[model samples]
Target: MSQELPTRLLLIRHGESEVTVKQIIGGDQSCTGLSVLGRQQAEALGRRWAEGHEPKVDALWSSTLPRAYQTAELLAASLGDLKVQMHPDLVERRPGQADGVSFSEFTDQFEWTGDVHPYVPLAPGGESQSDFFHRTGKALYELVHSNPGTTMMVVCHGGVIDVAMRVLLGLAPAAPFLLWTLNTSITEFLTTDKIGVWRLVRYNDSSHLSGLPTHTDYE
Candidate 1:
């Protein structure tokens, strides 16, 4: 008998969105759809995947946000119309009262002290960095256990990817970790036989965006 392959996860950040372009603070309330460039990036990602850039996945999952949903739809077009399952748990961290505020105002009001203390929330009624960690961890853990031994693709926000990395590597939620995942970028991981262990295969891969103008906004 042959040993079964470990579960493979392809984590993709959603394409550019109106909120990201306009420099607005969405906190999870930013439902604005993808911009024109965002659409092109999504299509390019699809072409890349269809051209053997990524393995055929058994399931597709996406955050409930409109930007992520639209991205998943566009990418699915190139992957044989892969059905996408929406997961609210995969959505970005909420900024609560700061949801629709301007970026400057949001930053002025909320202290980004997570690097010093991970339990700090962005604002009153918002989720703390620690809260984000457990939520993303639970969601990914369940996603993998439910779909054991298969490739899964999850389209979500950049912050979610950040949390996912921490969750997979058992890092402290509020640690000073900084990295950028470009629009429609790919981050790959694999579940190991050692229970609750995961291996990172790649991070922030945007080769599909080559020769294309890239978005320089948040994640």
Candidate 2:
């Protein structure tokens, strides 16, 4: 009998950015990076991950955006040996020219219902909610396939995280996830052929950042 493979995926949200504090859509935004506090948070997370002495990581992936890149860089730096790769597929929604717009402006300009449901298509002319679901979800599937039975860390955004949940868990596309993932927080999962069996052992874990900012800090 063959041993069942256990794949561990550490999904991390990028650190806070100026636009995050400003509450902008920030999708595909050309100009944005982590704030001073955000860098501190990422460093804290890197230290915790290093101290844990987790299994040798097979890969470190990040969204092409600079914020995601910055977070992954800190983590990889801590790992010392492992290398980081940039994947455009991991990028956040392309908010079109409407990027950096306030919530009010976003709602006013786009044909949105303010569904209060994140997975809903609130960003018109931008990638539809479903499109994002498939894009990020496909990237995850690809990563898992390559590393089968290995541990990896992926740095991305909240939207990608939500889409991944829907794809791997058979959840409704528009339903809200129970995750409150913060900058540098870890969400762990193991994926298998059976989507229903993909286990999320941890969700929105900030044990790596216990003394960091509160949830309300960015919200």
Candidate 3:
């Protein structure tokens, strides 16, 4: 009998964005893409892969957001120029009316006294925590099943990666601890022979950015 090949998924968070610097809610409508440092971070990761520091990526995907798409583009320039496939479902949590609002303004408008409900949207018409988790979980499941036995690179947001971890590890929707995924960091997962079994190959790997300036924002 032959051993079944495991599916490999590499989740990479987009580099620091203008929204992080400006402290604004960056939905698809307000995202202006990567900042100067952000571009450099993405370039650093690209160079790492170009130098054979990571495995060869069989496929490339990114969220529809500009920041994610731009990061994927930068990586592709070094990763055999792989065409990046955009997926709306892989985007960060939808901010809705808070798309361009600053953090201060958001707090002034909607103040939460205690732990917000999972079903309550952070912003008007936005996706609740539960909704975002479900969307990302479903998208990740589809991605893994659609391309079995292949290594895929997905450029998205930190929140999406967090949801991916929970979904793969069978954790609760409400995260007990923060992942703090760094900008342009890589989180890898591999599927096992048993159904719904996944192994965490690595998390928050940004070795290429050892000397590069990076941000600590939670976006």
Q: Which candidate, 2 or 3, would have the higher TM-score against the true structure? A: 3
Q: Which ten residues in a row have the lowest lDDT in candidate 1?
A: 109-118
Model 1 misplacement above 4 A: 1-3, 109-117, 192-196, 216-219
lDDT of 1 by residue, 13-60 (tens): 999888877878765665688988899999999999888856888889
Clashing pairs in model 3?
none
C-alpha TM-scores of all predictions: 0.90, 0.84, 0.94
lDDT of 1 at 50: 86
Write model 2 residue lDDT over 37-82, tens digit each, in one string: 7788889888876786655577888898888888888888777656
**lDDT by residue (tens digit), candidate 3, 1-219:** 112766889999999898888889999789999988899999999998999868889899999999999999999978899999999999999988889999878887777454778898888889999999999899999988878878899999999999998999888888687879999999999875547588899999988889876564544
- Estimate candidate 3's alpha-carbon lDDT, on a 0 to 1 scale: 0.89
Which candidate wins on lDDT? 3
Of the candidates shown, which would achieve the greatest TM-score relative to the real structure? 3
Selected candidate, larger lDDT, 1 vs 2: 1
State in Å the error of residue 37, model 1.
1.0
Which ranking of candidates, highest lDDT first?
A: 3, 1, 2
Error of 3 at 79 (Å): 1.5
Clash totals in order: 0, 0, 0
Greater-lDDT candidate between 1 and 3? 3
Question: Residue 178 of model 2: what lDDT?
Answer: 59
